[model samples]
Target: MAIVVNLDVMMAKRKMSLNELSEKVDITLANLSILKTGKARAVRFSTLEAICKVLECQPGDILEYVAD
Candidate 1:
C-alpha cells in the first residue's frame, strides 16, 4: 500500500508555484518540496490545514491511499 501525494497535480490546478505555496503556508521551501515530491514521512494537521486553507482544498486533494 502507499499514500500517494497528489501535490503536483493540485498545485497545477491551483495555478500556484512551490515557492509561492511555501511562502503562503509559512513553511520552509525545502520541507514543502519534500512533501510535494512525496518524500515526506508524515505531515502535521496544522501544516496540512495551512496548506488546505491556502490552496482551497482538503487533505483528500493531496493524499490518496493505494492498496498494495
Candidate 2:
C-alpha cells in the first residue's frame, strides 16, 4: 500500500502496548491491530483523533505516504 501505517513505530516510541493504547483510545484490540498492521482500509476521523490523543502524536506521525 502506498499509504503506510506507522502506528507500531509511534507506539514503540511512546513505550505503549497495544492493550494499553486500545483501552486508552476506547477501541477494540482487534481493530487497533488491523490498523497497526496496515490492514485497515479506512479510519474514521474520531478514531484517528482518539489514537493521536492517546499516543501524544499527530496523525502524520502514524500515517505516511510513499510511492510504490
Candidate 3:
C-alpha cells in the first residue's frame, strides 16, 4: 500500500497507550486497532480530526504517502 499509517510511532512519542487513546478519542479499541495496524480501507474526516485532536499532531503525522 502506498499509504502508511504511523499511529504506533506517534503513540510512542506521546507516551500514550492504545487503550488511553481509544478512550480519549471516543473510538472503540477494535476499530482503533484496525487503524493502528494499517488495515483500514478508509477513514472518515471526523475520525481523523478526533485522532489528531487527541494525539496533538497533524494528519500528516499519522498518514504518509509513498510511491510504489
The TM-score values for the models, in the order shown, are 0.96, 0.98, 0.97
Q: Pick the candidate with the highest lDDT.
A: 3
lDDT of 2: 0.97
Better of 1 and 2 by lDDT: 2
Give the per-residue Cα lDDT of candidate 3 at 24.
96
Cα-based lDDT for every prediction: 0.94, 0.97, 0.98
- Clash statistics: count for each candidate: 0, 0, 0
Off by over 4 Å in 2: none
- What's model 3's TM-score? 0.97
Encode model 3's per-residue lDDT on 1-68: one tens digit a residue.
Answer: 99999999999999999999999999999999999999999999999999999999999999999999
Q: Order candidates by lDDT, high to low.
A: 3, 2, 1
Q: List the residue pairs that clash in candidate 2.
A: none
Error of 1 at 24 (Å): 0.2
- Regions of model 3 farther than 4 Å from truth: none
**Which regions in candidate 1 have their CA more than 4 angstroms from the true location?**
none
